[model samples]
Target: MQQPPSHAREILRLAVPAFGALIAEPLFLLADSAIVGHLGVAQLAGVGLASAVLHTAVGLMVFLAYSTTPAVARAMGHGQLGKALAAGRDGVWLALLLGIVLAVAGFWAAEPLVALMGAEGDVRSFAVDYLRWSMPGLVAMLLIFAGTGVLRGLQDTRTPLLVATAGFALNVVPNLWLVYGLGWSVAGSAAGTSVAQWAMASVYLVMVQRNAARHGISLWPDWSGIRAMTRVGSWLMLRTLSLRIAILATVFVVTGQGAVNLAAHQLAMTIFSFLAFALDALAIAAQALIGKELGASNSVRARQLTGTMIRWGAGFGVVTGTLLAVAAPWAGALFTSDAGVQSVLTYALWILAAGQPIAGYVFVLDGVLIGAGDAKYLALAGVANLAAYVPMLVAVA
Candidate 1:
C-alpha cells in the first residue's frame, strides 16, 4: 500500500491544463474591466455591480457541472460507459433548463433587482443592458462547463484546455470589435462575452467525442443509463445547489447594502473568485486522481495524491491570494475611481484573500471526499456552511 511517487507527478501534469484554463476565465473578465475602465468611473462601477447580479444569478446553475463529473467518472470506472454519458447529458439538460429559467428571469427581473440593489439612473440602465445582453449566453456557458467536467472526469485535460484557450481568444476578438471598433458600449461587451461562450461550447462538444471514444466510451446518453445516472446524481446536484444558494445569499446581502457598496464588494469578490476558480481546478484534479486510485484499489495512493493536491493548491492559491491583497488598491482602481469604494474593497480584498490557505484545505478535502464517494459528508458540510454563511452575512448586513 505504499504510495507511488508517480501519482503526484501524474496528477500535477494532468492538472496543469485545467488550472491554465481556469485562470483564463478571470483573465477574460479582467479584459472587460480594462475595457470599461477607460469609459469613466460610473461605467466601471456599473459594470462591476451588473456583473455581480449576473454572477449570482447565473452562477447558481453551475452545479450542473460540479455534480456531473464525479458521477461520470465513477460510472466510467465501474465499466458503465453508457451511464457515464447519460450522466453528462443529464447535466447538460439541467444546465439548459436552468439557463432558460435564468434567461426569462434575467430579462424581466433585471430592473427590479437593480433597483433593489439601489442602482441609480445610469447604473440601472447599464445593468439592465448588461444582464439582458448576457442572458442568452448562460446555456452555452453551462454546456461548456459540463463538457469540461466530462473531460476532467475522464482525466483528459487537453481538450478543455484547448477549448478554453480558444474561448479566451473568442472573448478577446468580439470584445475588441464590440467595445471599441463598433462602439457598442457595455452592451456590446456583454454580447461579445456571449459570443465567446458559444464558441467554447461548440468547440468543446466537438472535442469531447474524440476524447470519449478513446476510452471505448460514447458521449451520447442511453435512456436506461440516464435513469440510473439521475438516481445517483440527484444528491450531488442538491449538495452543489445548496452551496451555490449560500454564495448567492452572500451576494444578495452585499447588494442590499447600496450600489457603491455592492460595487466594491463585487470587485473584491471577483478578485477572490479569480483565485478560487484557478485553484478549484486543483480540487477537480484531486477528485480525478482520488477516484482513479480508489478504482484501482490503491487507498494509500489516493491519500498521497490528495496530499499532493493540497500542497499545490496551498502553494498556488496562497501566493495569488497574498499578491491580490498587496495589489488591492491598483486592482480596485482599475474597476472604480470612487475613493470610498476603494477604501471598502481594500479591506474586503485582504480578508477574502486571507482565507485562501483555509479554503485551499477545504477545496482539496472537498475533492477527496467526492472522489471517495462520500457525498453524504459533503451534503452535511454544505449544510453547515449554508447555515453559518447565511446568518453571518445577514448579521453583517
Candidate 2:
C-alpha cells in the first residue's frame, strides 16, 4: 500500500523514533530471557511465567496512555494548549494512582502469584526475587507509557523514541556487569531493566514538559479539565484492562498446561510481539492523526486518516509478518536451545504471523475507535470475546 501521499515519509517520521524507542522494549524482554536463560531453563521458565502475570497487571493501568493520547492530540489540534497541558498533569496523577495500587499488589502478591504459575524450588525463588526487585519498574513503565502516548498524540513520536533509545543503550552496560561480571543472575537483569525504565520515564516526562512550554501550553494542571479527562479516561481504563486481561488469560492458560508449553508460548509471543507492537505504532500514528483531525472539526479528515491507518496496518502485516515467518528459526535460537521449545515456538510463530493481517485490522480499528473517544466498544468487544478466546484456546489445545 502506498502511503497517503508522502504518507510513507510522514508515517516514518513518527514511526522511526517510535520503533527505536520501542526497540528498548524488546531489549527489556530479551534481557529478561538472556538473564534467566543462563540460569537454566527452569529459572528462565519461571521468570517468563511471572513476567507475563506482572505485565498483565501493569497493563491494567496503562489506560493512562491508551486513554490520554487521542485526547491530548484533540486538544492540541483545536489549539487548546492549556487543555492539552492539563491532560498531561491529570495523566501523571491518574497514572501514579494506578501505579501505586499496582506496585503494592505486585510486591505483596509476587510470591503467591509465581507459586500459582506452578513454579517451584529455586526457580520460584528467582521469580519472586525478580518480581520484588522489578515491581518499581512497573510504575515507571506505566508513567512512561502514558507520557509517550501524550507526546504521540501531539504527532511528536520522535522525542519519545529518542528517550527510549538512549535509555535502552545505557541499559546494556549495566546489564553486562550485573549478569556476567557480578553473576547476580535474574535479579541483576531485573535491576538493570528497572533502572533503564526509570531513565526512560524521566526523559519522557522532561521532554513533554519542555515541548509544552515551547508550544506555550500551561505546564500546570487544571481541575476542571481534569474532570473531562476523568470522564474520557474511565472508559479507556476499562478498555485497556479488558485487553490486558485477555492477553493475560492467554499466558495463564498456557502456564496451566506446563512449563515447556509456557516457555514455547512466551518465545512465540516475544517474537510475535515485534510485529504486534510495530503495528501498534502504526495505530498510534493513526490515533494521533485522526483524533487531532477530528478535534480540528474535520470529520472527513479523521475518517481519511482511519482509512490510511487500516491500509498501512494490512501492508505492515504482510511485510513484517513474512519476515518473522522466515526468521522463526533464528528467533527460537535467540531464546533457548531446547528442542521442544524450538519446535513449539516455530509452529506458534507461523500461526501468529499468519494471523497478523487479521490482527492488524483489529488493532488499527481499535485506534480508529479510540481516536473518536468511542473506547466503550473496545471494552465491550473484549468482554464479548471472552467466550470465543476461552473456548478456542481450549479447543485448539
Give the residue spans of candidate 2 off by over 4 A.
Answer: 1-9, 211-227
Cα deviation at 369, candidate 1, in Å, is 1.7
- Lowest-lDDT window of 10 residues in candidate 1? 225-234
Best by lDDT: 2
lDDT of each: 0.73, 0.76
Checking candidate 1 for backbone clashes, the offending pairs are none
Write model 1 residue lDDT over 101-144, tens digit each, in one string: 87888889878877776667776788778778888877687778
Clashing pairs in 2: none
Score every model by TM-score: 0.87, 0.92
lDDT of 2 by residue, 1-397 (tens): 3336765666667766776665567767776786567566666776777677777776666667777888888988899876776687678766666778888988999999887766777767877988887888888988897788788777888888778778877777787788788988777878888898898888777876786788786756666765776777677667666666667767767766776787787666666665667777777777777788889999876766677778877887888778878987667777787888878888888888788888777778887788788888887777777756777777754
Stretches of model 1 off by over 4 angstroms after superposition: 1-3, 79-83, 116-118, 209-233
